[model samples]
Target: MGTLFRRKSRMVVVDFLPLPPVESKRLNKAISETGFCSRREADRFIEAGQVRVNGAVAGLGVKVTPDDKIEVNGEMISKEVPKIYLAFHKPVGITCTTDTSKKDNIIDYINFPERIFPIGRLDKPSEGLIFMTNDGDIVNKILRAGNNHEKEYIVNVNRKITQAFIRQMSNGVPILDTVTKKCRVERINDFTFRIILTQGLNRQIRRMCKHLGYEVTRLKRMRIMNISLGKLKPGQYRHFSPKELQEINQLLANSIKTEEASEN
Candidate 1:
């Protein structure tokens, strides 16, 4: 027993090197990861002193360690991985809302196992590719009007499109108390045109066409950002490939990095 004790003491000798302290992450991220709200909204909560970590009021810029207890509005947040991202080609006549009050909302058409909300929006009368995700972080990155994510559309009008109308659209049109941003427009057929817009105003295409005295019969968005609706029929959806997800994440990362660098 004496020998064994001696051996254990010898093995337990402390090292001279100091151990690294555990780093703390921002409280906003912890709340946002729970899928409750976006990081921006989380910051608002933090500023309002509505969040508590380890029985202390969580202030803005306060860091949270792994073992720390977190509570929001007196409710404990479950640390679970966020839900998956998805994209769907919304069919015409389907509203982009989750409210059941709307009889023809997109939520009724989706058969996914998880609750996913549309990232942005496509008008009920317009059919095209729409991204749906539980990740609120990516929504601002993708939908910021200043981000200039190009949206390509094929629009069918009732009458033949004139060169003057194309020029006006490509230059800029007045709508929503603001001048529409410059866009790319090309004639596809006698009454069809393909237009690519970098700005998304509410019912922009319809309002623009209305200003030109032309009624849009159909408007289909073929692309958003770098994701194309290719071969994905209307009213159908598929999981984003690994490569596609990587590309989108990279785009968002770059945008955030750029913004941070500019601020610094």
Candidate 2:
């Protein structure tokens, strides 16, 4: 009997000896990764006392283990929630913002049953393929400058295409205080050309055209890495196939994955 009690006492002591620093995640990122909301929005909700870690209210930047019970507005968040990845054909005049306060926000426009955000912006005036996903973890890996993911676009300028223009655009053009990366530019015909870029800057193509005295009459993204726009029409969205997702995972295998620490 004494031996069993001593063993029980030792077990209790061991349990209290501070758990091997549980592999934890910040409350907001975990929430966002579960298709609940964006991390920024999660932060806002946490500050407003709508989020809880374990049974207690959560504070900003609180670290939580996977086993911790988390809730928002009295509803428990499910870690097993399905992840959604989509190819959305953004039409001109629709915004890529996640902000619900704006009428043009993509989230509101799509009205997906669950919350989601566009992976990156497709400026309101520009149209074409853009990715939207409920998984916040992959957003940075795909968008970060270091990854070098390719995005192809077909562009139409106001003036006729010139060989000099092709050469300048392909080699590099100074924009946004830095020279644009050398990208593949192929002349499709006069006034239209195709460009595949590994880097994205604010209104990059438009700015590149303006630098050379050209006005962009039309600009539409055709592809993003392994995914293509295909025949998806304006304001339409389709889920990624398992094979496509598999290939995408393979493509990003060497690219960076956003871990919990850096995300906070």
Candidate that would win on TM-score: 2
| Cα lDDT listed for each candidate | 0.78, 0.84
Query: Native-vs-model 2 lDDT?
Result: 0.84
- Tens digits of lDDT, candidate 1, 1-264: 122234644754444566699977777776666665556667988888889998888898888877888888887876675567776988888888766578888777885665566766888778988887766567677876677777899999998899999999899989879998899999999999999987777888888999999999999998887789998888889888889899888777745311110000
The residue pairs that clash in candidate 2, if any, are none
Looking at candidate 1, what is the lDDT of residue 56?
A: 84
- TM per prediction: 0.75, 0.84
In angstroms, how far off is 230's CA in candidate 1?
1.3
